[model samples]
Target: MRPKITLALNSLLVLAFFLLLWQVLTVLLHVPAYILPGPIAVAAVVGSRFSSLAASFWITTQAAAIGLAASILVGIAISLIFAQWRWLRRLLYPYTILLQTVPIVAIAPLILMWMGSGIGSVAFIAFIVCLAPIIANTTQGLISVEENLVHLFHMHNATPAQVLFKLRLPHAMPSLFVGIRISSGIAVIGAIVGELFAGSSRVGQGGLGYSITYANAQLETNYLFALVLAATVLGFLFFFLGIFLEWYFLHQWHESRRAESGN
Candidate 1:
């Protein structure tokens, strides 16, 4: 089948399956809107609160963007440091894994309490959540460089900086994208967690977390669903943006992209 047709069919299948399950639950379980609002109700709420939702979304997106950028810069720097020092890598690797496994939810409130809430807290949380994936992936990419290639560079009297820039960095592009994709999802979770703990009462900040809190307090299930759907869409957008960037950069020469092209 043509790619477009295959994609369309898959999308339709997914939508149909979800709709079917939602309708069944709504009808058979007699689930109240308070407990689980139907998709239609959620969509309606989304439409009605588009303006307010859009503002909240913008705030969250800004926070995520700042944090992800910081992650990329810091992760790359840390990776390069480790790549240059094998012993340092060995010493730090276990601690890196420990950081990734630590629960962000548990730490978020502490972050807020320390930072005194607002954008600083949210951005810090997002950075903490997103940084690990990039650091790990970048380190893998740097170390994965071929021994023969390194020897060739050395024989050519290449400086360490030259070798890193001309060889390892280029080779690491695929792994970099992998880290970026993982960081995208983590950034969204970080932002939401941050909002849960550090949301502002002032206008023009905070996001789905605050919306959900307000709607729940007011017993507006539909509105709560709307906020949640907004968050889900934001997460999906981050994931798909990473995918598109990966394809755009790697499609010319990468093995995965080449396979797709051949098909």
Candidate 2:
């Protein structure tokens, strides 16, 4: 409790300090609102368009969540296959990096042409962006089973299924969550980029990415910053989800997480 409270208080203090510094700098530098809106200006914009921001945020959040779910399911399946077959990992693992190296911007257009607009394409983009981390981490974890334990199982004539179900998957949880935490950020990026090519939602509705583009086009800097802040909050929310899962699953038994109290 002490550590958690200390961390939370530190985070709040840092955030407040930066916000104060930003306000002071904006005033001292005589920065125009169009160039750089201070926190007060951004906060006012947020208040004025709170409903619209909430709607857009909800849309993006749904898309990102769906994509993240798909990535987790598929990533685990793929990792299991790779771990079960050594040759397959050697043959195909190199290409996993391609998923990261390839720019989403370049492929976003192709996906748009193929799938057109809406959540389908957006979710696909996000899935592609977030899938790599899950695969890499899960595969590493699944294969990182203790050699002594593995040999003991073998010596005991334990079947592959028993060894896998009883040993490997459990051991993989820590690394899997690490990847999830990393992928949480990537998922947000994918959703926003996906929205860029997916186009605005029907009529005036769309995700924060659309709002950002629209605000920039009209030079509504304060509103743009507000939208950006909304996205930032969404990203943090997604990341906290991974943290919660890690604590839930790891706290009880994992030494790294320290006996169910805290990680």
Highest lDDT model number: 2
Q: Across residues 1-263, which tens digit of lDDT does each residue of candidate 1 receive?
A: 59889999999999999988997889789999888888887888888888998988888887887888899899999998888889999999778886689898898888888888787778788999898999999999999999999999999999999889899888988999999999998798798888877576574456767666777888999888788888888999999888898899998889976785667
Per-model TM against the reference: 0.91, 0.91
Tell me the lDDT of candidate 1: 0.86
Worst 10 residues of 1 by lDDT: 197-206
Error of 2 at 189 (Å): 1.1
TM-score of 2: 0.91
lDDT of each: 0.86, 0.89
- Kindly list the per-residue Cα lDDT of model 2 for residues 102-186, writing each as its tens digit: 9998999899789978888888899999999999999999999989999988998999888887889888989999889888887
RMSD of each: 2.2, 2.3
* Model 1 lDDT, residue 99, Cα: 64
